[model samples]
Target: MKRMFTLLALVWAGSSMGADWQVTQSDSISAYVLCHQGDCPVRTAKVFDLPVAVPMPARVSDSAAKPVTMHSSTSVRFALASARLSQTEKAKLKAFLKRHRDARRFLVVGSTDQIGKKRFNETLAYKRGMAVAVFMRANGIPNRNIKVDSRCCIEHPPSTNPDARRAVISINE
Candidate 1:
C-alpha cells in the first residue's frame, strides 16, 4: 500500500509539471563554418556554440539534420591560397554530392581563406565551387540540378576556428 501510494504521487507530480505552459525554447541549425587561413590567425582554433530543437521550422526541411556531412583538410589548410578542398578532399566531395543525387537541385557554394588577393581568391573560390558541381555531373547527377557559386573568402573573418574553411552543399527537391 505504501509503495502504491508513492508511485501514484510520483505520477501526479509528473502530470502537474506537464500542465505548465512552455513559452520559448532554444533552436539552432548545426553547420560547420570553416575559418579561412588568413582571415583567422594561422594555427589557432576558435570555438562556438549553436543550439537546435525538435520539430524543426515548418518552412525548412531535411529532417535528418543531425548528422551533417563534413569534409575537412588535413590541417587548417587551403587548396589554392584560399580554397579549402584539396585532391584528397575531392573524394569526400564526390561522396557528399552523391548522397543527394535524388534531389532536384544541389547548391555548391565555395569559400576561401582570408589570406590571398580578393580577385584571385574569388576566381579560385568559384572554381572550387564548380569543382564540386563538376564532380556531381561526372557522377551521373544532372547538370541542371547543380548550381555553383563562390563568394570569395571571409567578408568578415570568423574566429580562428578551422571549421571556418568550409564550403557547404545544400540539396533541394
Candidate 2:
C-alpha cells in the first residue's frame, strides 16, 4: 500500500511538470497566481520590479472664451437688383442654419457686383443682409444674435471673375 501511494504522488508531480503558471498584478498591489492544475503551493514569490506611475495630462477649461468663425462654402446668390433668395439658395441657407444651431452669434454680410452704382449697391447689400437675418430669425435664431453688415463692393470679392452679388453668412461663438 505504501508503494502504491508513492506511485500516485509521482504521477501527480509528473502531470504538473507540463502545466503553465501565470501571475497578474494591478494597482492595488495584490497579485494572484493561476495554475493549470489544482492549487499549487506558492513558494518564494517576489516582484523583481514595479511599474512607475505616470502623471495625467492637464485638461483645457471649458469656460475659456474663444471666438470661432465659420463661412458658407457656397455664396447665397441673388439676381441683380433683387434681394429675393432662390429656392436653391434657401435650401442651402437652411442647411447651414441647421448645422450651426449652437452658434450664439451670426454676421450676415452682403455684397454686390461693381456693375451697379455705389450707393444703390450699398442699399442692395444691406437689404440682402436683412433678408438673411430675417430668415434666421424666422428659423428660431434670436434677433439679438444676428448682426447685419453690408460691404457693397469695398472688400475684395470671394470670387474674382463671377459677379460679386451674394450674401455671406459668418457664424461666431
Candidate 3:
C-alpha cells in the first residue's frame, strides 16, 4: 500500500512538470498530505501550486455589432420660382422630420426650373435648400447634421420635361 501511494505520487508529479501533490489515501484515521515535492511523509508545503490555462472569447467590431443604416427621402415642392414655404408644405415637412428624429444626417437638395438665367437659378436653388435646412434646424435638428445641395436648371431624376422646382430631403439613420 505504501509503495503504491509513493509510485502514484511520483507519476502524477512527473507528468505535471514539478506540480504540487495532495495525497487522499486511506489510513486508520484518514487525512490528507499536501506538499510541493510530492513526498507524503516529509512535507515542504501546505498549499497547492499549479498552472491552469483558460481561453479568451473572440472579439466583435463596432460595424459588425451595429445594424446597417438605410436611407429614406422626402420631396417637398415649391411654388414656381419661389423659395418660400407654404403653410401646408411646412406641415408636411414637419411631419416628415418628426418621423425621423433619430436620423443621423439630413441632406437637403433644392432644384429649379430651366426657364431662368444659369446664375439666377443657382442662387434661387441655394435659397430654397437653405430654407429647408433652416426649417430642420428649427425642428431640433443640429446644424452639423444638415447639408444643402443646390441644383439649378439640371434634372436630378432625369426626365423628358425636367422643369420640376423642389427640395429633396434624404435622411440616413
Candidate 4:
C-alpha cells in the first residue's frame, strides 16, 4: 500500500510537467515545444539558458578558376663565342621538342658566360635562341606560339663549367 502511493505521486509529478516539450540532438542541441491541440500557450513560450545551433552554408571548390601551368627546360651547349648547335645537342633538342610538342607555349632562352663583350654575348644569346626557335618551328611548333629570349650572361656567368654558355629551351602550358 505504501509503494502504490509513492508510484502515484511520481506519476502526478510527471504529468504536471508539460508533455509538449521535446529535446533533439544534432551537431548541437535544440529544444522544441510542439502543441498537438489548438492554441497551447507553451508553443509561444520563450526558452531560456539553452544554446541554439545555426546551420552553416555548404562550401564550394574553386579549382576551375585557376588554370594549370606546366614548364620544362633542356640545356643545349654551344661552342665558345659561337651560336652553332652540335650534332649531339641537336639530337637532344629534337628529342626534347618531340616530347613537349603538345605544350601551349614555348620559350627558347639563350644565356652566355661572362667571357666575351657584353654586346657580343647579347648577340650570341639571341642567335642561339633564334636557332632553337627555328628548329622547333621546323619540327612542328607554331611560329606564334614560340617566344625567343636572351638572358645574355645576366644569370649564368663564366665558370670552368662549359654549360654556362648554352641555349635553354623552355616549354610552358
In candidate 2, which residue ranges exceed 4 Å CA deviation? 1-74, 154-163
| Model 3 lDDT per residue over 1-173, tens place | 99789878777766587655465655665544446554545546667687786777876567647676868888787887799999988999999988888998989999887867889889999999999999999999999999999888874433453436888999856
Tens digit per residue, CA lDDT, model 1, 1-173:
99689756765665565532212334764332233334533454656775665785667767876765434222212444545457666676666655655567777777776666878777877776776667667788888887876666675444564433456677644
Local error of candidate 1 at 112, Å?
0.8
lDDT of each: 0.60, 0.77, 0.81, 0.77
Writing each residue's lDDT as its tens digit, candidate 4 over 42-156 gives: 4356769867788889878787776667778888988888888889998999999778778978888887887778899889989998988888888888999999988766545
What's the true lDDT of residue 41 in model 1? 32
The candidate, 1 or 2, that scores higher on lDDT is 2
Instruction: Tell me each candidate's TM-score.
Output: 0.47, 0.55, 0.58, 0.58
Candidate 1, residue 130: how far the Cα is off, in Å: 1.0
Residue 34's lDDT in candidate 1: 31
Looking at model 3, the pairs that clash are none
The residue ranges of model 1 lying beyond 4 angstroms of the native Cα positions read: 1-87, 155-166
For candidate 2, list the clashing residue pairs, or say none: none
Report the alpha-carbon TM-score of model 4 versus the true structure: 0.58
